[model samples]
Target chain A: MSGTINHGLAQLAAVDQGFFTDRSGGGCIQDNKLFCPGWVADNYDRYVHPTLQHLVLVGSAVAAGFLIAFALAIFAHRHRWLQTPFLAGTGILYTIPSISFFFLLLPITGRGALTAIIALTAFNLQIIFRNVTNGLRNVPANVTEAATGIGMTPSQVLWRVELPLALPEVIAGLRIATVSTVALATLAVFANGGGLGTEIVTGSNITFKTGIIVAGSIAVIMAILFDAVLLLIGKLLAPWKRKQALV
Target chain B: MIPLPALTLPTAAFGLFGDAFNFVFDGREAETGGVTVGGTSQVLDLAAKQLEVTLLALAVAILLAMPVGLWLGHRQKGEFLAVSAGNAGRAIPELALIALMAAAIGVGLVNLVVALAILGIPPILTNTYVGISQVDRASVEAARGMGMTETAIVRKVELPLAVPTIMGGVRTAAINIIATATIAPLAGILTLGDFIIARNVYGDAGVLAGAILVALMALALEGTLAGIQWAMTSKGLKLKRS
Candidate 1:
C-alpha cells in the first residue's frame, strides 16, 4: 500500500511541475496546434498531483460524511423525536454555499485540506442523512418483527435485516454524495487544499487553454468515475436492485 | 494531550467568529482604488448583483429546460436524455465550468450568466421529468377518457399533480445557482464573491461578511421555496400521503 501511494505521489510530483513551473523554452506552436505537446511533456506532474489531491479531498470527505450521517440516521431512527431537528439542522447546513462554507472554515482551519474536508463533509450531511433515515424507515416493519420473533436482538435485526434492505437507498445516497463531493472538491484549491481547480484557476488567469482543459476535464472525469464506482458498489451490494433499472 | 489542528475546536472557531464579528462591526474603512468600498451599503449592492445574476440564470435555465423536461416526461420517451443530462450536470464542477467559460469567452456578466444557467438546468430538467412521470397514470387516463386532448390532459391534470416535485427541482436549481454565483468574481463579474475572492483587499472581516450574506441569501431562498412547495402541493395529495 505504501509503495502504491509512493508511486502515486511521484506521479503527482511530475503533474505539480507541469502546473506551477513555466515552460517558456517549449515553443507554443507545434504543427500549428494551439497546445504545445512539448510543454505538456515538460509539465506532466502538474496534472497528476492536482488530480490526486482532488480525489483525496473528495474520498476522505465522503467517508467522513457517511460515518457522521450514518450515526445521525441510526440515532434518529431509534429516537423518532430527533428526526425533525436533525434533518432541519443538516438541511440548513446544506444550503450554506460551498465557497462561503470554505471561507467560514478558513479562519479556524487556516486554509488547508482540513478546512476543505470539514466543509465538504458538512455539505454531504443533508444528502446522506436524508437518504439514510429514509432507507432505514423504508425497511418493512414485518421483517424486523420476524427477526425479533426469531430471538434476534434489536441490534441484530438492525444489522442483519434492516440494513440489508436499506442498502439500495443508502447506496443511492452515497452515489449522489460522492459525485457531488468530487465536483465540489475542486473548490478545495481556494482553501489551499490543492486540487484540479488550481490548474483551472491558474490557466484562466494566464489564458492557458491547455491547462484549463486538462485540469477541468480531469475534475469532470473524476466526478464521473466516482459516480460510476458508487453505482457499481450499489449494484454489487444489492443485487436485487439490478432487476429494476432505476437510477 | 493529543495535538489538534487549529480552529477545529469550538473555542478557537468561536474566537475567529468573534474576529469576524468585530471586522464586520468595527473594522477600519476599506478602500479600493483610493476609494472607500467596504460597508453595509457595499454589501447590499453586492447582494443585489448576486440576486441579479442568480435570477437571470434561473430564468434562462427554466426557459431552456422546463419545456423539454415536461414534453419528454409527458411522452415518457426521452428517459435516456433526461438521465444523461442529469448525470452530465452532476459530473461537471461549477468552478471548472466557470473557469472554462472565463477562458473561452473572456470575463463578463453574460459569460457568468451562461455558465450559471448551464449549472441550473439539470436539476430543473430531472425534477420536471421525474415529477410528470410519477403522476398517476390512472388520473391521466381518466382525463383522456373525459375527452380531454393530450395537451389539455397534461395542462390540467399532469402539471397540477406534478407541481410540488417540479417546484422542488426549481428550488434545488435556484439554490445551486445562488451558491455558484458567489464565485462569479473569478470571471470578473462583480457579486458577493468579490469580497471573498479578494480577501487581501477586503480583509478577513470582508470575507466573513460576504460569507454571512451569501449564507443568509441561500437560507432565505431555500425557506421561501420550501414554503411555496408546501403551499403548491395539492391538498388531496397531502391528505393521501398523511
Candidate 2:
C-alpha cells in the first residue's frame, strides 16, 4: 500500500513538477534566438498526444452513453414499473458533483482516463436518457394510431414511425452530449491522462511560459470547429424541419 | 427586478446551508484541530459571484436575444435559426468555451462571464425566437389590421403573449449557467469550484463537502428558476405562486 501510494505521488509529481520546470528559454523579439512563443510552437506536438487521448476518452464515453441511454429509454418506455424510479434516479445522478464522483471512484477506477470517462458517461446518461424518452414520447399520437391500426407490430411502429419522428430531438441531444463529453474530457488531465488542461495546469505552475495562451487558443479553436461542424450536420439532417421553420 | 432578488435569495441561502452541511460532513471523522472545512467560504462567495455573473450574462443575452428573436419570429425565421444555431450552441461544451475565454481574456471573472454567456445564450435566444414566432399569427394580423404599428404590435401583442415561452428558455439558460459556472474554478477563479478543485488537490472529506455544496447550489438555482418561470407565466399576477 505504501509502495502504491509512493508510486502515485511520484507519478503526480513528475507531471506536476517536471512538466512545469522544463521550459525552453527566454528572449525578446530581436535580442535572442529562443523565445517563449517559439518554444510553445516547437512543442505543439507534445500537446497533440494528450489531446488525442482526451478525444479518445470522450469519444468512447459518448458512444457508450448513447447506447445505455437508448436502451434505458426503450426499457423505461415499455416497463411501467421502471419509469418514475428510473427518472428519479437519473435525475439525482444528474445532480452528483463531477469532482466528488471522480474522487469517490478514483480509489476503485485508479484515476486517469478511465475515471474521467466513467464519470462523464454517467453524468451524460441523465440528459441523453431524458432526451430519448421525450423524443420517443413526442411522436404524434395520430401517427402511432395509424401504425397500430394498420396492424403493425410494436417493434415495427417503434422502428418505423416513432424513431423517425424522434430522430430530430435524439440527434440534437447527441450533439449536445458530444460537446459536453469533449469539454469535460479535458478534466481527465488532472488524473494524468493529459489533455489541453495539462497545458493550463502546467502554465499556471510556471508563470513565465504562456502555456495558458497556447492551451486556451487550442481549446477555443476546437470548440468553434466542433460547434460549426455540428451546426452543419444538424442543418443537413433536419432540412425538412428547417424549411418548415423558415416558412 | 424585485422578483429576481427575491428569487435569488433562497438560492443564496441554500447555497450557504449546503456549504455548512458539507463542512460538517468533511470534519466529522477528523481530529478536532486537524480537520479543515476546505474553503467553504470561498465556495459560498463564489456562488454569490456566480449568481451575479449569471444574472449579468442573462441580462445581456435577454437584451440582445429578445430583439433579434422577436424580429425573426415576426419575420417567420425563428425555426431555422433556432435549430441551427441553438443546436450548435448546445453542442459547444461549456468547458471548451471557458478554456477559450480564458485563453482570449486570461483567467478571471471576465473569462467566466464570457464563457457562461456563451452557455446561456442558446436557450434564451432560441426560446425568444421560438416564443415570439409561435405567438398566434391571427392575433398579430388582427392587431396590425386594426392600425397598431409594427413596433407596437411587437411590444404589446407579441411580447406579452411570448413571455411564457421565452421565460422557459430564460429559465433553462439560467439553470445551465448556474451549473456550469461552477467549472470556473478550473481556471483559478475563486468560485464554488475552488472547493471541488481544492479537495481534488487535498483528498480530504472537504471534497464531499464541496460536492454537496455545489449540488445544493445547483438545486437552489433550479428551484428559483422554476419559480421565476411560474411567476412569469402565471396569469393572475400573484407575487407568490401559492
Alpha-carbon shift of residue A117 in model 2 (angstroms): 2.0
Let me know the TM-score candidate 2 reaches against the reference structure: 0.72
Identify the leading candidate in terms of DockQ.
1
Residue-wise lDDT of candidate 2 within A1-247, one digit each (tens)? Answer: 9999999999999987766455442332133221257666546777786667666776778888889988999988888578778876766555554544564444345456666677778877877887788888878899999999999999999988888777667766776677666656666554554566676565334232255555645655665566567657767766655422110
Q: Which docking category, incorrect, acceptable, medium or high, applies to candidate 2? A: incorrect
Model 2, CA-based lDDT: 0.65
What DockQ results for candidate 1?
0.51
* TM-score of each model, paired residue for residue: 0.89, 0.72
- lDDT tens per residue, model 1, A1-247: 9999999999999987775445632554223233556656776676787887887888889999999999999998889999999999999888898888988876666777878888899999989998888888888888899999999999999889898888888888888888888888888777777888888776326356566676777877887788788788888889876632233
- Across residues B94-199, which tens digit of lDDT does each residue of candidate 1 receive? 8878877876678999888999999999988988998899888999999999999999988899998998879977987897899889989888888988878887
What ranges in model 1 sit over 4 Å off?
Answer: A1-38, A203-206, A243-247, B1-5, B8-19, B22-27, B31-33
Q: In candidate 2 chain B, what residue range of length 10 has the lowest lDDT sum?
A: B1-10
After superposition on all C-alphas, the RMSD of every candidate to the true structure, in Å, is 5.9, 9.3
Q: Chain A only: TM-score of every candidate?
A: 0.83, 0.77
